[model samples]
Target: MDAPSGIISAIVTGLVIGVLGRLVVPGRQAIGCLMTILVGLIGAAGGLAIANAIDAAWLLTLLLQIGVAAVLVLITASATGRNQ
Candidate 1:
């Protein structure tokens, strides 16, 4: 199914947010571009869940998109010492 313009834009934004978020935490991701995009999408969804639980404001989704994902990457990297 084809996505609407808004959905497409959101996907692009999420992809960009994911790349930046990963970069925030030091590591060699060694993943493909597609994987990076996938990670970003997953991170955004996870962030949204946490944000919703914490009652983050509506306007901050994009920033929270990056922040939450970055925090997630940081936590995971610190814990595993490697991405699995």
Candidate 2:
């Protein structure tokens, strides 16, 4: 897929991943739905960049985005936990 296609698909995929991430890494993030989507979007971009750097296949970027989003969610959850 081309750049635009990747981005479009990422947007859709990221939404699901974002919610899954939040549920997996539970905490009082208090993030609204829009904010969660934003975080997922950013995380997907970051993941894609890293994938490009490492010459990862296009299909892998999809997986990368989810993995990164999950990690970010987990980290954020842990951070909030520590703060409390």
Candidate 3:
């Protein structure tokens, strides 16, 4: 993929993963869209790295991504003192 498409893909993936992560969480989060996207991007990258290392399947990879995003969301919320 080219740079532009890769960037766009990353944003789209981040938005989806971020929303999924937020939904999976037990309660409402105090973070905004941008924070969620950032969390999602980091989570996706981390999850991909771990998945690659472990040779995880596609479903497992996605689950890992969402799980990582959820964890990050929790951390971010706590760090910001806005967990609700």
**Residue 4 CA displacement from its true place in model 3, Å:** 1.3
Error of model 1, residue 65, in angstroms: 3.3
| lDDT of candidate 3 at residue 9, scale 0 to 100 | 95
Which RMSD values do the candidates have, in order? 4.0, 4.5, 0.8
The reply for model 3, stretches above 4 Å from the true place, is: none
TM-score, predicted candidate 3 vs. hidden true structure = 0.95
Which tens-of-lDDT digit does each residue in 1-84 have in candidate 2? 899998788777668768766665645566657756766887777788989999999778767877788787766556656413
Measured with C-alpha atoms, the lDDT of residue 17 in candidate 2 is 69
Pairs in steric clash, model 1:
none
Score each candidate by Cα lDDT: 0.71, 0.73, 0.93
User: Among these predicted structures, which one has the highest TM-score?
Assistant: 3
User: TM-score of predicted model 1?
Assistant: 0.63
**Total backbone collisions, model 3:** 0
Overall local distance difference test of candidate 2: 0.73
Instruction: List the candidates' TM-scores in order.
Output: 0.63, 0.61, 0.95
Q: Against the hidden true structure, what lDDT does model 3 obtain? A: 0.93
Candidate 2: where is the Cα deviation over 4 Å?
1-13, 23-30, 81-84
Residue lDDT tens for model 1, 1-84: 457987887678668877888878676655556656666777788778867878888657666777777875666555655664
